[model samples]
Target chain A: MLVIGELINGMYQNVGKAIKTKDKSIIQKLAKDQTKAGASMLDVNTGPASAQPKDAIKWLVETIQEVVDTPLALDSTKADVIEEGLKLVKGKAMINSTSADDDKLNTLIPMAKKYNAQLIGLAMDKKGIPRDRNQRSELALKIVSACMEQGFPLEDLYIDPVVLPVNVAQAQGVEVLESIREFKLLSDPSPKTVVGLSNVSQGTKNRSLINRTFLIMAVGYGLTGAIVDPLDKELMDGLITAELLLNKNIYCDSYLDAYKKK
Target chain B: MAVDLLKEKWQNKVGTITIGATKAEGGTRASTVTVGGQSTLPFMFGEGDMPNKPVIAMEIFDIIPEEWPATLKEPFKDVMNDPAKWAKKCVDEHKAELICIKLQGTHFDFGNRSDADAAAAVNAVLEAVSVPLIILGTGDEEKDNKVLAKVSEVSKGQKCLIGDATDKNYKTLAASCLADGHSIIAESPIDINIAKQVNILISDMGLPQERIAINPTIGALGYGMEYAYSIMERARLAALNGDKMLSMPFVCFVGQEAWRAKEAKGPQSEHEDWGPESTRGPLWEFMTATCMLQAGGDILIMRHPKAVEETRKYIANLMK
Candidate 1:
């Protein structure tokens, strides 16, 4: 499973303070800690809290790369903010999102190709989040067809099924899982599947439990990646154990330790 | 329909390692042997990169062996009792790339020689040969600690690959190897999990993963060699798929295990239907080495000059 470290967003208090004070140490430490915790990539998002979100994303990308070499996910709703980070990334970069909306796809798909970046396509559009499995699949088909039409490589595309909180949208939880399974069938070289994993546990007291349980279940439905807190020990352990049971990792007595070191 | 490629973009890779150090690098070896850094399974030619070829090391013991079969004993007959002469013959006449000195005399049940004697023998071989060396200890933990630690001290800057650091007795020898600037071999029974655990323990003791080679304990042909093959195959696949603990280059004691088998021993009079024992013995050793190499063995510690010659030819062809 590809772990996109989600601890460097401007919405986090420590990160927000670091961005405000221009403290590169705090950002570098977060980058090192998450990479050590098994993050295949880090998400650089200057959340809605950043007054100068464009400049903040660039600064975050530069500061993180100064310490660790893990790849970055240029995360933002704005194509221009993601583009700015793309300009500075030394390795392959990823766009945090493009929704099923035609206009957003038009702008971001070419930007993804222009920057040679992987893209995360959300299963929502300008109309809003779909409420059922069929609706989610319909939007996913739209995103896949758009990428195909633009000559974008499906292998570099990750389609997120737009996970919603189980407390408020209990029925849609099953839809998201079904959407994850259906996403793979949309193209010959199927787009990889990911989820904004924390969204599944919003407002819940059992956040870690809920997130890990759902993440493992999603993995059963062919999910290949997740944007989650790599520092959450229990969640990461559950993910490793789940992959082990799935036979993705070779069995070793100290497999958990091996997974962490890798 | 358009063809779709199935290649994997591996996130991590097996670390490359260099065994011996030269004069420029503070050691007196004429050259060093490098291994690992493979990005795919063995012989997956077009699929991934295999940066270094597997190395073959001839095993020369410190004391004359009491149980070597006649076929294996014949090649080293004259130098059987002399460690330095045996090592020199292996490199000079046998075309050996590396020499492994097995200090069996240090075992409590064996000669139980003093550490000073072991160190003296090691220094003699170092002076006699310019090729790289792998200094192995007796299986006895306490005796090996004393003998190998002394060997490490004497060969301080030689950068020889030294050890058989097990789950139980890794500290003394691993520390000595680290301080003396040598790569150490981490051994495990025919189990992948234990193999990985041994490496993790070694790494925790401050041995960098790159300086360690793995010995997934050898099992001879028809004597559970398949189990060793399977374990090695899994370890290699895991390493290619980015598992760090099982990522070290594998080393096997092929000659030790092959010679111990009855099929590779016993005269024709004892087993007439098994064909001529002389050719059969070396053939058995060669077959075992070939299979293990296919399953990702990067270094083979072998006996039998004929078998080593055949295996070297095989490795040259396979690498090409």
Candidate 2:
């Protein structure tokens, strides 16, 4: 699984305060923590708490880069902020993300090309996250089609099925998984599938348990990447064991340690 | 009419490691055998490169194997008493590509031979064969650590594939193999994860991944062979998909595992409908081995001469 650590976002109190006060230690520590916890890339988002997302995004990128050299995922609703983070990324960056809407696609696709970065396309539109599998597939195909039309490689695209909180939308969990499987069948060189893995358990008790169960099911349905809290050892262990049983990883007695080392 | 055929281009190739260093390279072997480096599934001719054809290494024990069925023991009856002559017969008479010297006598439960005895037996076989050698321990962790290290010491710089290092007792054997410039076999009990972890551990000890092979533990044709087959298939697929830790070539104990099955070695009088044990035993061995080869086995340790010949001929034709 391509783990994009979801901790560096500016929504959490420490991150929000860190962005405001320019306290590099808090952000840098999270960066080092996530990287050490098996995150291939760290998602940098100036979440709703940020008053100036563009500046915060750039600062987060620069601050994290100062410590570790892991790849960054620039997350924002505004293309300009994402573009700001992209400019400062020392290595490859991921745009997290674009919706199926034409405006987001037109802006982010060009920015993605300009930055030479992978893209995360949400299975959503101006109307909002789809309620059913067909609508999810429709939005997914739109994102895939836009990527193709823009000459962006589908292999570089990660189509996210926009997971919702399972407590309220339990029926949609099945829809999201089915959408993930269908997303792979969208093109010859398929757009990789990702999920905002934490979204499934938002505002729920046993959040980690719910997220772990859903993530394993999603992987079975061809989910390739995930936006997750890498520091969550239990969740990470579940994924490691799942991938091992799926034969995605070779087994060893110390596989838990081996997975972390790799 | 022109036809378009489908093909896959894999990102990783199985690692190739040569056994038996020549005199110039530090060993006295006449020739070396290199296996692995396949870029596609076995027999997928037009798809990718099979850089080296899979080779067969016939197993010769330091001490005569008493429990081997009469069918298996028949060919080696004359030479089994001497490891050197037995190894020579396997090479000269049977056209074996490599000789796998099993130090069966060193096992604590077996003869419990001394380390010096084990070293002498290994030296005797090394002196007798021009072909490459695969030096296997007796499969007891404690005895293997002591004896394999000794065998490795005596055969230093010979580039033998020293083997069966598990997750528990790998450090000793891995360190020994690394010191002597020989390759190591990372053994897992038919589990792909353990197979990869053993490789990682060996590599972690500074022995390069290129100098390792995975033994996922073979099962006979009727005896959980599908489990072994699937494990091999999955390991090969992961290797081709660019999983670096899994890209090492695989070794399956075809002769030992196949002969253990009653269908292959049991007397024909016990079950009349199963046909004569003469052709039945060798055929059982051949079928199991060929299936394993198709699943991307790089080096097969086999026993029966007829099975070895048939498998070699089949490999020659398929590789062509």
Candidate 3:
């Protein structure tokens, strides 16, 4: 349960507002609460939300580190913003993105390796987010190869299979699942598979409900990590329960303790 | 010795781990204890050096526990009411080399004690015992951070293990340990990939591999302990085979898990042919601990004094 807390990103309207106003309080609170809630790394994304994206990212990273010791997952589409975030991050942070796109790879992988940061490479190339299992697997391999070429350890690269909304591509969920399974078999030493868990349940009523269901399913398919909202007790609970039942967590003891606290 | 084939074949080194920080290293403990750095399997000195022997830490609670079985209750009696006394008994009577104090009361679902309360309990135990200490947070991420942050700050300069850095909350916990100069136990649900991932995540925070301990989460006998054992054995193999990121020494929480099984706690009347509660209880813990030890566990956290005593004798015999 490597919970990369998703609460600090711009995609959320409240966080976006917080970013625009230079409201350190809101960002600080999010960092504290998420760390308290068990986020290993707080994902900081100020994409298109701040007047000065680079500066805001830097401030968020610095402020969060000041209050808590948790690592930051510096997230942004712009390489420059990520570079700025990396500069401010005290320890090696994770880059939220790179893709099979040659340009994105050429720009981000070198930057990631240079900063000693782990990378989350999206399984999307110039073709954009794949709609089929074959394309998804192919893109993952391409991204992994690009990372290896840049001398990044396979362990340092986390491959996200670009989870799409189930409503639009209902069967694509199965494809994504198959792709994750296939990706694990591609190499003896393969990059870990992470999913933007919320993406699978996008545009659904009771989004947390769907997100959690999909998350459990993803974990079943060898999904090793996730970028999700740690505050979603239901989803977190589901993940904890799944880990226990799968015998991944010995003794099935932590669930009671985990649930009561949540 | 047939030219000592085992020595010739086994060349992997599991790094050594020393519990407690000495005064020269900046801690108040009377002395430090070391384990691991084995070049071969347990007690195979004919092959390679077992530089440091395995050590045991007795598990006690910050608050009096209500959910424990009556058999467990019979051992500590009133002392369980006081963590310091309980911890002292573990060190003095049980001969535990370390004490693992679990702050179960701070859980949001438990008494929900404040961070200050948990810190006071931790400090009290540290003051009472000369042995190295391991402080565990209530499993609630939010509460864990609040309490563990306080523990880390309060216990600064003492190289105690502040657990359990999970994938979700490792960064904050790892960072806290890094700043405070303490060791951490990085716990991953029983998967090699996750174990590797967490090690990487903690290391990314600039914490050295020596300062981190990995817990792959153990299972008791008849409760998937075999799976956990295999995972741990494989992890140790990977490390010895040279996976730098997965090479840290490992710890196992044998007490918390072994005592939870039905064989250990279920009514004796229900399984008359099985045996008395006293016999079955310690046996369960012993079997679980033994399984993990063979799988390369560097540290074991135990509960029953009898089990701990039995395990010590077992280790002594194996070493000889």
Candidate 4:
């Protein structure tokens, strides 16, 4: 699974202060810790705290790269802010992300191609989060078609069936899992599927339990990636076990340790 | 419809390792033999990179064997009593890239030789042959811990690959190898999980993953070689698929296992249709080594000069 660490975003209090003060140590340590904890990529979002998300993006990318070579996911609702981080990242990065609205895709797809970046296409659009699996799959189809028409490689596109917090939207949990399975049938190779994993457990009492249970179900539905807290040992262990049971990783007694080291 | 084949974007590559150090690197080997750094399964060059070719390590003993097959014993018969001369002959005559010296004499039943005796034999081989050495201890777990530790101390800085470090007994040798700058051969009894766990345990003891090689204890061609091969194949796939704990290179005992089989040892005098022992024995060893190399074995510790020569030719052919 492509685990993108969600802990480095500016929304986190430590990261917000670090961004404001230009604290390289905090960001660098977070980058190292996340990668060590089995994140294949780190999501770098200059959250609402940053007065200037654009400049903060560049700082985060440069600061993280100084310590580790794990790839960064340049995240922002603003295409221009993501573009700024794209300029500094050493290799192909993931633009996290754009919803299935034409206005966003019209700008981001070409920009993603211009910078040679992978893209995460959220299934919901400007209309808002879909309430059912069929609507989610329809929006996901729109995103896939847009990428296909724009000549962006399908495999380079990650399709996120945006999950709402399960407390109020219990049915949407099943909706998201079904959408992940449907997304794998989008094309011959299929679009990679991811989830904003923490959203499943938002405002929940047992956040880790909910997040990992949802992740394992999503994995069963052929989910390929997740934006998650790699530092959560139980969550990461659950992901490793899910991958093992799915036969994606060969079974071994120390697979949990092996996954982290990988 | 015209179709395109799918290929994997391998997320990780096996770590490269070099055995033996030159004069400048703090040891006195003529040249070092490097292995690992493969990003694909053996011979799948187009899918990924294979930085180094698989190399062979000729096996020698610290003591002469009591029971010997006439065909298998021909090459080293003269130097059976001498470790130094035996290693020299392996390097000079068989084009051995590495010399694996087994401390068979240190076993309590074999000879009960002291650690000092083992260290002397290791040093003598180091002095005789400039090729990298692979020092292995007898299977007696407790005694090997003491003997290998002392030999590792005496041969410090040579960067030889010494081991047989198992799940239960590894601390003494792992520390000595770390202190002496040598790689270890972690052995597991045909179980991939135990194989990975051994590496994790050794790495936890402060030896870097690169300083370890896996020995997924192999069987001869007819005697359960498939189990070993599948385990190695799974490990290689896991390694390339980003399993760092299982990513180390493999060291297989091809000649030892092959020679023990009746198919490789049975002479025509014993069985008329079994073929001449001369050709059948070496071919058995060669085929065994070939399968192991295909399964991603890095250092092949083999016996039988003809078989070793054939395997060397096979390796060159596979490289091209």
Chain A alone, TM-score for each of the models?
0.98, 0.98, 0.94, 0.98
- Tell me the whole-model lDDT of each prediction, alpha carbons only: 0.90, 0.90, 0.83, 0.90
Candidate 2 residue lDDT tens string, B43-149: 89788899899999999999989999999899999999999999999999999999999999988767899989999999999888888899999788888889999
- Give the TM-score comparing model 4 with the true structure, all chains together: 0.96
Interface RMSD values for the candidates, listed in order? 1.3, 2.7, 11.7, 1.5
CA deviation > 4 Å runs, candidate 4: B1-9
The per-residue C-alpha lDDT of model 2 at residue B58 equals 99
> Which whole-number lDDT from 0 to 100 does residue A81 have in model 3?
92
Ranking by TM-score: 1, 4, 2, 3
Candidate ordering by DockQ (highest first): 1, 4, 2, 3
Please give, for residues A1-262, the per-residue lDDT of candidate 4 as tens digits. 8999998888989999999999999999999999999899999999987899998999999999999999889989998899889999997899999998999999999988998988999988878889888888899889889988999998799999998998989888888888898888878679999999999889989998999899988888888999999999998898889889988876666678766666
lDDT of 3 by residue, A118-152 (tens): 89989887756787899888888888878777788
lDDT (10s digit) by residue, model 1, range B118-197: 99999999999999899999888888888999999999988888979988779998899889999899999898878888
Kindly give the number of clashing pairs for every candidate. Answer: 0, 6, 9, 0
Off by over 4 Å in 3: A1-262, B1-11
lDDT of 1 by residue, A68-163 (tens): 999999899888888899999999889999999989999999999998999999999888889898988899899999999999999899999999
Q: What is the lDDT of candidate 4?
A: 0.90
RMSD of candidate 1 to true structure, Å: 2.0
Candidate 2 on A92-206: residue-level lDDT in tens? 8899999999999999998899899999999899897788999988998999999889999887899888899988998999999988888778899988988889999999989
